[model samples]
Target chain A: MNKPKHKKLTCLGIESTAHTFGSSLVSLDEENQGTIISDSRSVYQPPPGSGIHPREAYQHHSDVCSGVLIESLRKAKMDMDSVDVIAYAGGPGLGPCLRVGAVVARSLAAYYHKPIIAANHAIGHIELACMLTRATNPIVLLVSGGHTAILAFSNGRWRFFGETLDITIGQLLDQFGRAAGYASPSGAIIERCASKSEEYLLLPYTLKGNDPSFSGMLTSAKRLLSSGKNMDDICFSIQETAFSNLCEVTERALAFTEHDEVLLTGGVAANTRLQEMLTEMCRSRGSTFRVIPRQFSGDCGAQIAWVGLLSYLHGMRLDISKSIVRQSWRLDQVDILWRH
Target chain B: METLIRKGAEADIYKVRWNGLLAIKKIRLPKGYRQPSLDAELRKRRTIHEATLISAAKLAGVNSPLLYYLDKSNYSIYMEHFDGPRIKDVLDDPDLGTTKIFEAVGRSIGSLHREDIIHGDLTTSNFILISDGCLGIIDFGLSFRSNRLEDKAVDLHLVKQTLESAHSAVADEMFTDLIDGYRSISGDESTNRIKSVMRQVQRRGRYARSV
Candidate 1:
């Protein structure tokens, strides 16, 4: 216990996916993995309903670039040169947003003569979630604006246990928020609105085995709102229908995975209402429910850095040539070389 | 006479006495994984919705159980106790005929779809044989109001898929009889409207399985 098995690997992680552009520097536990030395992030929130203007997001990243990176180094209180590698969210994000992180990491790797690691943004969310929660072999419910999927880690990578057939849950919620006169990234507000009303409006409860569809539910919620349904009631009904669908599909996945832990990650994990539903589902199955704390739940650089370090430790590719941002990378496409 | 009858993910059912009358009680079990407030609301709402759906299915000409009482506080319902074997138990019975039961299964589902009511979980187990050899639809936990052909097709698809996976030998004959009953009850127009949608669903199912 006195000595660790492998030497610590220090890395700098940059995340510029969607509306968040930030950086973090961490020294990972080389043996057991995922020991965070330091973490930091900065998010760019636009007006409600106008989410992530790709060009504007890129400009925002460039505008606040130096401060975020400097803060991350300051947070770590480590010499910049001591970092062994530069890792960035490489794909599964807006091209312009992803390019910012890729270019930054590429230049840093070039300047430092170190390797560059390109990791999937979605997988970054799951990896950081698993690390922070310390959930081994857990079903990952990665729900964010750009993605919503039920992923199970197996063999060496995450596979789709089930995912959205139409729009992501985040989009589902945001659309309802917009229709109800809220701004973009309005999950928190929607949750509060839902809490205020207890009325249950009939909405489409679409579930095809483990997969689910929210397009119908979202449409119905909007129609009900316009027809003079109470705003709070519509909000409440939307969450009830949409979240219950999530719980049902997740329960099916749990039945298949038969794992003891369910890890909730991504931006929407902030909703306590959602946490409650998932918590109850897990408890019913005698399983554990773990979520990334509020601070780390959203898009964060620390998660990217830590995930890159894990993959790098396991001999994953580190070439800047092929680190292009993949706008729609599926989780199953990535070979999760780190986990056995 | 309280005797345990059935239990499922959302609720528990018991053959119990209601006002000294033999009735079935459906109590929505508290899910510990849910937040207390959300759980209570869901239990209350679903109990009421299920009870409402049961009656609507009956009005739509399906022989659903008669609802006797609604106890909102405990999130329970008292309904007429159906006597006879569950359709699942007699799905492939050698001595007992199964075609008529399958036809009734189709008609019950058709009746619900005809009224824009989707029986969320439409499986053989949710159907029971009554004393007169008629099929009674039970359990509306997942039922909802959606007139979309897609939703209706999905409902029919669930029944077909459940039978195919659970009762392979009789799956073909049962499905044929079920469709005949659905077409006769729902009429060719509405049934035809769902055929394309049903095909799309089957294709999606195949795609999901292949990958």
Candidate 2:
């Protein structure tokens, strides 16, 4: 059961879904929309070629969550007792990492006698972007290592206008980056490398009916790398092929939803190349385009904090006992009560 | 000069005179959101790819618009334009018989899948009923080359679901006849694969809901 709606509320949210653990404090701005007060994050960077080990990331979260929480409160200029409610990324993430955040959030909730809310990580990204950009029911192009979908909010639900049929563009790029001996989260570096490329290598293009498949193209790109192909050209090809597929899908979704605007979110949304492609698509379609700020584009606790604020305003709740983390929560499963 | 017929998110379809012939030009536009260098490459690549898929689909015995000219520099492809009612509108008309139309659509798609060419967009609107009564497939914008059974099955899945939502009145009849027509050209192995994968895709959709 949900508590009575709270118009002016301050919520603290915890996020430890993957390699990062952090806490965020959110409050309503003058426009009556959720805005981040402060966000504190500590990422677990793995050694080259080793990639992130889930167990290690969880341990990192456990060790840093408290410090992050303290810093978040300090930045918000509030003490523990000033928080109204507590929330965390409850599902649709790595299990061990998610558990760390859930445990810390529950402890903070009980200590402060505040209601606990379980927030969907995917919806959190959309809500935070909407709050900051004031976008009303625009088509959301979510591209991340864990997610790739063209989502539209309608009738209090997130509808999938199109999605990735196979591996996501983010994973593909990251894999390419790893193969190139770059560190994890190598999207930016790869983008930079791609910028220097003028030649194009033939790779499989698999954008199908607004959905995309990246495994084939990824395979080809990796093969090119192994055969000592030009790294810049390969990176350029990956961006050209994959981002085009993403825009193709988003464009189709725009036509189907007839939404006058598009909001690009998630970690992959931080890519400048993707932004330009999506912006170009939007401009041609006579629609407005908004990209979440780079700071908020990637996974973070601030998004969850803002979404929790919105959910609390919409009469939603998560009992402390029932706050188990879900590792495979999809965006469509959320009811989206906060949006009209 | 070209007169715009329809503008889609990915590309623009324009009616143009190609060497004094009535040709339709599909131009893959540059995405300003992407870097100009990458955007230019993407549009050029898609323009060429679509042109190739058109021929592949035709080689597989499907009736489709013929590609007459291609300009990679401007990212444009000139092709024959069929002046006919879209299959969607015909299916929507109660006075028209859709069984024959659906049968043709099924066979046309069956040949495409057999050739490892996924139409990507299988909606009825993408198929047009030309003057010869043969269904012409258009808009290979999202198409790709994939022989994998899963990809083919997803194509069928899209078709069935699109009809279910958009042509609710005749969804069952259309799908049943489609399968029947599909069986006429495709081998049992392909159809069997489609059946199994279609179930999996649908189940995945349902399971995702519970999560």
- Where does model 1 exceed 4 Å of error? A1-5, B1-211
lDDT tens digits by residue: candidate 1, A116-173? 8887778888888887788877888888887777877754557666667678889888
What is the C-alpha DockQ of each candidate? 0.10, 0.29
- List where candidate 2 sits over 4 angstroms from the true fold: A1-6, A29-31, A195-202, A230-233, B15-117, B123-137, B141-148, B157-192, B199-211
Q: Rate the local accuracy (lDDT) of all candidates.
A: 0.78, 0.80
Worst 10 residues of 1 chain A by lDDT: A1-10
- Per-residue CA lDDT of candidate 2, range A1-340, in tens? 1234345688898988888897999986445756688999999987775567899899888888889989999999999777887889987888999999999988878877899999989888887888778887788988887888887775457766666776777778878888888888788899999999978676776765656778899889999999999999899888877887788778877764457899999999989988987787777788899989999888889988887877777778778889899887877678876566
Name every residue pair that clashes in candidate 2: A91-A326, A92-A326, A276-B32, A276-B33, A276-B34, A277-B33, A277-B34, A280-B32, A280-B33
RMSD of each: 8.0, 4.9
Name the candidate that leads on DockQ: 2
